[model samples]
Target: MTATVGALAPISRAACVGGGVIGGGWIARFLLAGIDVKVFDPHPAAQRIVAEVLANAERAYGMLTGAPLPKRGRLTFCASVAEAVADAQWVQESVPERLDLKRRVLAEIDAGAPAEALIGSSTSGLKPSDLQAGLAHPGRLFVAHPYNPVYLLPLVEIVGGAATTPETIARAKAVLDAIGMKGVVIAREIEAFVGDRLLEALWREALWLIKDDICDVETLDDVIRYSFGLRWAQMGLFQTYRIAGGEAGMRHFLAQFGPCLQWPWTRLTDVVDLDDALVEKIGGQSDAQAAGLSIRELERIRDENLVGIVQALKAGQGGEGWGAGRLLKEFEQRLWAQAGGGAPAPDPTAPLELLEIRVSPAWIDYNGHMTEHRYLQVFGDTSDALLRLIGVDFAYVEAGHSYYTVETHLRHLGEARLGEALTCTTQVLAVDDKRLHLFHRLFAGPERREIATAEYMMLHVDSRAGRSAPAPEHVLAKLRAIADAHAKLETPAAVGRAIGQKTRLAAPV
Candidate 1:
């Protein structure tokens, strides 16, 4: 008996069979999505290792988005595969990539998990058909190969074996969507799925370059990192090449470059000898490139860089986003939907407490305080939060109407250092159909000392018409309600302060 894909409930409970790098990443991503996870790993250091990965994941997520994330789910370490899989909605096998061992463990999982529970194998280079050969419910097993640092990289190659059912694939995709992952289903099962196949070809050529002494590891890295690597990160290969074809497009690109495939420029199909000298040479060069940073340090640096790239992409093209950035924006919207469309209706009479920002290490400047522009960024975010509270959002703005800041007054009084937790409050000073007035206070630490204040005057504009316009009644209604409630409160002294006017910072809130 099989359940229709539509009948499948959202995945809330999951089981993992390994606790190394890949499996640890899987556990972290699931836990971050608020999915409870059960695990069985015989490694003695599994608990400590998984904890480190989860910490890194939490840090990365903080830098990724401001959307309200769900409460993190619980995790349990079990003594056996059967114990881990019991009652699990999904089971992921990420043990050593050996067909025989995977078959045995999956058979045990099939016996213990719910009959309809889907099973995913994290095999980088194994055909799922081989792993499913001996399982009683082979139709539920497939490959869900993910990249390194799986928590940060969103792509997952979903491949199903011959025995796998369409319903199973559909259900898995639903699970991926629920957790903000991008799963590209393979049309057929094969070893080393699409991503790895391309990576391996590149790896093969790269090794030959090193072995033949054309370039050392660092030089080779510099070549890629400084050139096509960036292009690959954004536009990808064929699309980048399409643009390279000029106005004639991909057809011209192929016509010009297709013949080069036969040239000896790449030794992609050739394998270099892994003799002791070559191995030592590569290892020595790699250590030199690392400059003695441990794996954890490197991982954190990589995570931060990835976050910066993704965030930039998310803000590109007038906030419409591009490629993976578009996916990330959509994911944040889904998160907002799950969290009741953002910050709840606040006490109308008081300043609306919108968000608390942890001063990231990245925010500190040469003088070791939050940089000047970040203050404006926080104020801008507060204004956007207010927009959402009043039924305005990305879709609202994209629909040809939005609030644009025409005037802003910002004052700074205190220093914000790394790791200092800061909170903000927004006060609705005034509002009408075509214009809005807002005041925000930035507070630091437990004492809630006011460190900064910002006032903004915004004009609603019809984007398509390129002129100021009256906002819709529905949006005006929510803003008016808050304005009315706040009208009774005394106005913040920060209001109407002239540029360069001197004033003492107030006491704690």
Candidate 2:
């Protein structure tokens, strides 16, 4: 069966024609999205290079989110482009940036790949029209330029050639969306596309500054990273500048800074010469900036930082997420929704196993065990799982009625170390029209033993009204079914016990 997240149907098979840096990244992203990939690259070290890239992608994905990723797709290294693209549903070409080379390779792919297969080129600056010139099925090809570390970055410029049909562009975009990527179709193809154009402008200015000894590479990087770069990550260029307009808005802001556009300070129109002396100065400063870290080490550090930033964004805007983080939130919602709908029936006599989690490295403390607040987080998530099980979902909450946890009692029984698998079982203690009583046990580590327990008192409320209220009968009925079934089990010893109550496992570890 094809593995799918959310309700999006993923492309079943993909052919990646080049396995260099960008190629490998494309391959990893597709495979992680549960699409089998066939790869063809003639470079002797291509396999090893792709393997390393895949390892990093996996580590990054593990830290990125706790949502259940679909099962990984099978990877096969093929000898020829024909073998790889013979029957693939999608084809990606990541060959080096030479128009002639790309056309030659795409010709073979065009002949061997299924006529209807979606094909994309990873050319940073080349136009899709130039690359499509020699293909028999030119309408199937487009430029899908992505940034470095394609797996983590969400943006992919989808620029169609003159010969490319609208249907092909739409299909390409659909596949990108299904794989949790953002594909912005450029209205018209240009030499360097949108992102690279902006980047090249900045690079030109930076080069001129270095050539004139205005600032070292390190200093230039620090200035950008410490200020506007942060804003750019969450909000793009125009949006950031719009805020600069202040209360007056973009028109006023543009009028304020518009005069600066003609200033002589910028050398954007002039190209900086990369003479030997200038190259040496820039290269030496870059070496010092690296501070002795290897390329792979720097990549890992960058990946970790990107993961944290995106995760924080996902928790931003009051948990509604912002920008790309919002997309992640929506994607995770779909994953959870699909999983919930397809889950098997729970054993009525036992506590409902509502959630399972992997302890991410980000959650570890100096003690190297799961940290203090994460316990509360786990139990809170467990409660959320129960709430979702009983119909307090996004729509229910959106309607302005929800079960609010009024009280929580947590008993941390033992340590939960890093990378451990954990699960939570919740037993409903009592249910009423306006209140809910629940007991939750958390199992940690490979053994999945009981490591913690939480008891909660939730009050149903009309959030818009700011008062307690009865939940709809539909919700109450499901609650009644579970609470009645749980009534058969003996009450937990800690059910009503306050903090500091004596028990065999109560003493501090």
Best by TM-score: 1
Model 1 lDDT at residue 303: 86
Alpha-carbon runs more than 4 Å astray in model 1: 1-9, 341-350, 358-374, 393-404, 414-422, 431-435, 444-451, 459-490, 503-509
lDDT of 2: 0.87
| Per-model TM-score on C-alpha atoms | 0.87, 0.85
Q: What's the C-alpha lDDT at position 336 in model 1?
A: 62
- Give candidate 2 regions above 4 Å deviation: 1-7, 275-280, 344-374, 389-392, 395-402, 412-436, 441-452, 459-494, 502-509
Local accuracy of candidate 1 as per-residue lDDT tens digits, 1-509: 00011111287899999989999999999988878899999999999999999998988887676666777778999999999999899899999987788888889998899998999999998998998887888999999998889898888899999999999999999898777788899998778989899989988888888888999999999999999988887799999999999999999999999999889887776788989998999999999999999999999888877776787778787998987788889887777655544334678888998776666555668998888988998889778878878878868988999999999999998988755667888989888879999999999888888899999999999999999999999999999999999999999987999876675567699
**Model 2 per-residue lDDT tens digits across residues 1-509:** 11334334358899999999899999999988878899999999999999999988887876676665666888999999999999899999999999889999999999999978999999999999999897899999999999989998988999999999999989988888877889999999998999999999999999999999899999999999999999999998899999999999999999999999888888999999899999999989999999999988898888877876887788899999998888888877766566566545567689987777766666778998888888888888888777877789877899999989999999888988755678888899999999999999999866778889989999999999999999999999999999999999989998987877663455497
User: Highest lDDT: which candidate?
Assistant: 2
Q: Give the 10-residue window scoring lowest on summed lDDT in candidate 2.
A: 1-10
